[model samples]
Target chain A: MIITPIDSTAPPEPTPTPTRTPTPPASSASVRRSRLGRTLEPFGFIAPTALLMLVLMIVPIVLVIGYSFTDNVILNKNPEFVGIENFVTVLTDGVFATAIGNTLVFTVVSVIAHLLIGLAFAMLLNSPLVSNASRAVFRVIYILPWLFTAAVIAVLWRMLLSPNGVVNYLLSSDLEWLSSPALALGAVTFINIWAGYPFFMVSLLAGLQGIPADLYEAATVDGANGVQRFFNVTLPQLRPIIISMTLLDLIWTSQQFALIWLTTGGGPINVTEMLSTFTYKLAFSRYEFALASTSAVLILLFSMVLAFFYVRHQRARD
Target chain B: MSKEAHGRRRTLRVLGASAAAVALFATAGCSASSDSGSGDGGDVTLEFAQWWEPELPDGAFRELMDEFEAENPGIKVELLSGPYASTKEQLFAGAAAGTMSDVVGLDGAWVSDFANQGAIADLTALMAESDYDDSELASQIQVDGATYMIPVVNFVYPMFTNDDLLAQAGVAAPPADRSEFAAAANAVAGLGDNTSGWILPLSLEAPNGIQNDVMSWVWATGGSMLDGGQPDVTNDEVTSAVEYIKGLWDEGAIAPGAFTMKEQDKVEEFTNGRVGMMIDSLAHINLIRETNPDLKFSISALPAEDGFDGERGIPYASWGIGVAESSEHPAEAWKLVDFLMSEETNAKLSSIANAFPGNTESVPDFVAEDELFATAFEIYQNGYPANEFTGLPVAEQLMRLFDEQFQVLLDGGQSVDEMLQKTQEAWLAEF
Candidate 1:
């Protein structure tokens, strides 16, 4: 749990005063009552949200984790406790291995693309050369892809990358972008970067805006060039936002299902098979609910490890 | 009465009237139930969920439903139709929630899984009572010793050729053997740059496209998708068949987007005069005829490999209606099935569907008169069901594994031998 700025705004830390002595409760019962009241006070405010999280998030996760240990296929009337059979099967399966590799590659490539492209756009938008009206127009244009549903965007891209589609028509090249096994994953990764960069751009732009103008002015006075200022001032200032956005982008990209499913259905082969799509196919298409649940738990573990590593890396950099 | 008292009295009168009206409506519902029981008045609506196109300019199915309602007097049909993919999805959801329709239109490939899951009722008793056991379609819908579906329409997947394209390419006849098919395809490819000699559905967009569409060739070469209820893709016959397809691909006879085109896309391409020939179900014949009336086309069985048995692969797959296991009104549901599978109704509907009727006695005059349909009917009666070997509960997964490996081969990333070995290993692990 990386502490955000909101967490820093909590109640002031207690200070010890040598000159003034504070009186304590006279009775143990009164002290106990005070402690109990204090302990439960925040819970009163959090109870509704806690209950909601328990029901909507925690409950389903628990059920999935439980089901992963059983032979809980949808067609099976009674799911018997099979211990770790499903997990063992999932671990031994080659498709699961392929899915893991695909997911990692997809996440890393997509996050990097989003960061690089987003940073570039943010810089361009923040530049003195761009007019305010132009900045506003470009912002709208850049974020437009995010506004459309994933299904619609996927379909639009599918048509565009189709064998005889607009891409081929315009380029006069007979490239099978979405259908070729070698090219399909790259095509989807490109689409994802296009659709996702806007989020990064928006967040990075905000972070960029929040940096004090004096810092850049000071860097300039110290004989720092534009590149030097960006590296020393801009990047450091935007570290927290970059870290959080990258973490979110990694999770979202790994869990992406609809766009890949709708466009290539995880393949000309399983070339574009992500863990999310594969898990969905296991449960819905194959009715292997237990295996799917196991895969899902594995994904949760992957996300946790990724977040942990990112937080640690950020701490090390600091 | 005083003015305030009079207003209160008026309100009470209105409430009294409303309560009486509600009571009368409740009574009427009871009476309707009673009337259905007595078979004297009122309608017994049976919900029928299917994936067929809802309306086709005075389609035979719609007409038959109207006729059945009029003839039966007390029975009415409520249709729940949607696209096939979503309908199958909803069926699974409905099964889990115990809210499945009284009768469901099921693909033949799904029968085994659904029956094993106990999602559908065993229709053995009903069929015996109705003497439907005599129908050939009955056996196709049976698993082990139990029948679970009333087959309505059976499709035979055969090769269809655009006669004009074949003629333009100076090909005189439909190919009857693999070598000839390849030659003809090359010839057609030579006709124009825009034209493809053959269109192969290599896209695993849907498992059915790969499992049934492309695998039909493997079957034609006397290869089976499964061996003894286990996933087996590395057998010599199947491997050789795939190699032959790869040979076709190598020769540039296959379409440009062979790996992306769905079955429907292939049909669309063929109808648009882009492909000389395509392998698809007989059900698409009517669609092609209606969509491209000027495109002279002919249908034939898939070409068999040399030195193999003369019998080519003609898929005898079907779509049928089944009573839900949880249906309360099994008798009423059976009535609808019986009506739909009756000789006359089945003939009319199956004709429109461009399929062989489940009712063997109901081969329409048109089917018998047309040479192509007659050939398809003969094949439908004699040929093995496309899903006979691999229609197990794990069919989809098995097909997916094959699709993955086959795709590598298609992309020229792996040899046929290596692809087969990898696919076999995956299959063994899964099984």
Candidate 2:
């Protein structure tokens, strides 16, 4: 028997022995129908979700946009289109300007603080110096604030920060944390940060664990100090997660209405007024639904800009 | 196609069709469930949406509805109850969608807006059509000469003073005038251990604080926030009241968190003996009594200015009721309204709610039994029930706008003149 070695890259020679009848190609109409079925198949699977989104989200958005151009809709039996009048009114209003400024400060500060605190906690939890049992305990404790709903968080913080509440008793100072024009905005923001940081912490914790040990070891071998290793290796490794979480937090925090509403109610004197509260007051409190719609549309556009960046970042990462 | 590919495609198509059917059925099911009481039946079921059921004593409102159902053989009433805020939101949403309940619990403040939008039926027309006697009704909220709402029960705002605190400060009685109120407030503050003279809740969230507390001062002096149904917030009486309140704020006589405090907080402060006084609703009398049984308190007419000598204006809020314009059974809804407004039912409801009856011919029995109610009744008889915000367009918004400026005034961020001026402008814009 002759042992032959086949060239691996070469095409195999075809061996022919048996004969078979040829199958005829189908008619053009059947082929077209099959192609159409393939195309329509995925849509069928998603039809329910698509229908729900249309009814719940897209329809409301379109209606609100339409309303922004009208005069006192919902309350008016026959609202006439005013075309940008509501937009002008909302833009020129001083309260809307104040709401915009406050929303920006609240969003920017919350996102930055959430990132820093979340990263710090994630790193601490990820540390090998800690026991697994201790980490698990701390993780639950850290995540406790996030477990509460907005209403619960608002009520809890209100009780805790009242003039004669435990916070005051502990500090031995009678500060009106949720009432003072100077303090209310900062107070609500702190509560939001507390309630929100756990999301980032959990996400970054998983990201931290996923980073290979070799990068840190390499940095350590290359004369990198702990801080240097963190800046050079850990932070860079966590950058994508940081960006994604930051954008998400920005979106969530900017739209925070329930906490502010349940707490200071955007007052002493509009000190804590966010765009969400401003729009709500116009529609519900003031019954100026058209004006509210205008404000809402503006907020939607702003959110879409943030969402654009988020989507772009996500795509690039993918 | 291969047999496997053909099978896969068939499976996908079946799954898609099933999903579409499920979605369609879900939507249809929701629509059917939402139209529950509107179904065709031998008996008509009227959906009554209200916050009043929760406010009434447990099973009291339900008993009243049972009585109505018993009296009318072919009619049934279904309650949709919630807190005031949630109820208001639901009613507004329903109104916008033209799906409001057959009968609605309305705030007097909401009548003008609801009527303007044609969301509520014109009671004047309903009354005429049914030949319902409107003479016995105490008052009707009207817009454009058409009645849109009628008060079912009235809750007057009276001055509530913590007797123990007043005694501790050597104050002999509840203040009868603004000057006395100021002096007594200061005295109470001077004897303080974190205790303030008064709790003035001016929260913009629910700025009835302005209507019930701040404006009650002006109203108590027979001053009106309106002149011929127009904004008159910068009038002398309103200015004087604002000045008086500002004086208290400057002297630290008002509660610490007045800007953010709500009606509930005001009641809480008075109940806990943390504050000496508050202008509070009669609706809260039972609540205060229940929350702090040992807290001694007295009710009085909101104090007038030093030298004013006219019949005082007593600020009052009402549990106003209306029929939805979109109600299919408008006649049946009117019957329920008429039943609720009857002399016997009105008296019974007022007694249960600790409020005054809306029927001119009826008096709540509690007025005879409860001393506080007797005092309130005498006060009500002597003074006119005044609330200019009621029946005004965007009344709550007016209160909130005034609240914002008044808050600024209290914080010393603006003068009383500026506050009134700005508030006047805001009010005029709404008008």
| TM-score per model over all chains | 0.79, 0.94
Report the C-alpha displacement of residue A147, candidate 1, in angstroms.
3.0
Total backbone clashes of candidate 2, pairs 3 or more residues apart or in separate chains: 0
Candidate 2 chain B — worst ten consecutive residues by lDDT sum?
B33-42
Deviating ranges (above 4 Å) for candidate 1: A1-52, A169-173, A209-224, A306-318, B1-45, B53-78, B96-99, B129-133, B136-139, B191-194, B218-240, B285-296, B306-313, B351-356, B363-391, B411-431
Can you give the DockQ of every candidate in the order shown? 0.18, 0.49
In candidate 1, which residue pairs get closer than 3 Å at backbone N, Cα or C atoms, i.e. clash? none
Distance from true location, Cα of B17 in model 2, Å: 2.5
Per-residue lDDT of candidate 1, residues B101-202 (tens digit): 888998765777778878888888776676654544534467777777766877778889889999999899998788889999999999865798998776
Instruction: Give the 10-residue window scoring lowest on summed lDDT in candidate 1 chain B.
Output: B31-40
Fnat of all models, as shown: 0.45, 0.74
Per-residue lDDT tens digits for candidate 1, residues A14-77, read 7867675555656768768667755755555455455557666898899999989888656677
How far is each candidate from the true structure, as Cα RMSD in Å?
A: 10.6, 3.9
- Per-residue lDDT tens digits of candidate 2, residues B143-166? 989999999999998888999999
Q: What's the C-alpha lDDT at position B184 in model 1?
A: 93
